[model samples]
Target: MENEDIWPPKCPECGSPKVDYERQSEYTGGGYADYWDEFQCRKCEFTWRSDKKTSYF
Candidate 1:
């Protein structure tokens, strides 16, 4: 894997750079897939993190 960004990274959205980060469960049903660092933009609802580095929700 590549070097991942640290917590409180810039928001991929709005680009406001104001971001909120938290640890959340990342399992669907089976065993724990992994923990994720969820990030939310202060401006928009656009949220993402280490878990969805390629997409946004």
Candidate 2:
């Protein structure tokens, strides 16, 4: 679970602090109705979605 209070979440694959965060949209019901918190590690290029219940957008 990633917390918004925590900046630069560590990469789960590489454990690097050099990470980027973004709120992405997903296709749902034939439209972009769903959103997700995306995290990418700049160091290792590892990517994952936040498991937090709170939505970013």
Candidate 3:
């Protein structure tokens, strides 16, 4: 399960409006970094950070 507090409404990288939740890996038994809310930028290829500060956004 994922905590809502750890997700971001927008991407902090390129500041694009295009953002969504995604899994880093599709394979099972993956590490923590394998599962995260990925943000896609429409203007650039910059992705959001999955760190602690991401929740603050």
Candidate 4:
């Protein structure tokens, strides 16, 4: 319930609510990338998008 205002804006890799702009690790073949997706967790470094910003993968 840390980020209740945003509800479930969490990282699936670490369950952290520290999501932000996609990290540079993603372009370097970080193993997590998607079409139209551009968000990542500052804690676990997981990347993803949602809703209208959802990924094709």
Candidate 5:
């Protein structure tokens, strides 16, 4: 994806704009699991995820 499509999300805890995308994981088998992309805040060390099957990043 292009850089514009994968823009970093803000930190929910501190509302910091200096957030970074860490990684992503998706369930391969037919089991129940959530697809998500991990992110971290550079300012506060806050971590979070976007639990969507289809992610922009």
Candidate 6:
């Protein structure tokens, strides 16, 4: 695995940098509530979720 693969989340089917953030949701019913972010690939139309929250503060 290269450094780029270990960093940004890429489409598993097609490797493309044309990725877009879909939306964000909060899960409060789980054990530990967390904010998740959704992403989609413009080239392949692949979608994925990430739990790494971002703080603007």
The per-model lDDT (C-alpha) reads 0.66, 0.74, 0.52, 0.57, 0.73, 0.69
Residue 24 CA error for candidate 5 (Å)? Answer: 1.6
Q: Residues 1-40, candidate 3: write the lDDT tens digits.
A: 9665644455566666566656554334333223344666
Runs of candidate 6 with Cα error greater than 4 angstroms are 1-8, 27-33, 52-57
Instruction: Candidate 2: give its CA RMSD in angstroms.
Output: 5.2
lDDT of 6 by residue, 11-49 (tens): 766988778875564555535445666878999898888
Candidate 2's C-alpha runs over 4 A off are 1-5, 26-33, 52-57
Of 2 and 4, the candidate ranking higher by lDDT: 2
Tell me how candidate 6 scores on lDDT: 0.69
- Clashes by residue pair, model 3: none
Q: Where is model 1 more than 4 Å wrong at Cα?
A: 1-6, 26-33, 52-57
Residue 52 lDDT (model 4): 36
Candidate 1 residue-wise lDDT, 15-43, digit = tens: 67778888765454444345668788878
Displacement of residue 52 (Cα, Å) in model 2 is 6.9
TM-score of 2: 0.57
- Predicted candidate 4 versus true structure: per-residue lDDT over 1-57, tens digit per residue: 454656446787888877775323223244444334467788977767653322222
Model 3 clashes, total count = 0
lDDT of 2 at 32: 31
- What is the TM-score ranking, best to worst? 5, 2, 6, 1, 4, 3
Residue 7, candidate 4: Cα error in Å is: 5.7
Off by over 4 Å in 5: 1-6, 30-35, 54-57
Residue pairs of candidate 4 with colliding backbone atoms:
none
List the candidates ranked by lDDT, beginning with the highest. Answer: 2, 5, 6, 1, 4, 3
Tens-digit lDDT string for candidate 2 (1-57): 857676757788988988989987654554335666889899889889976443333
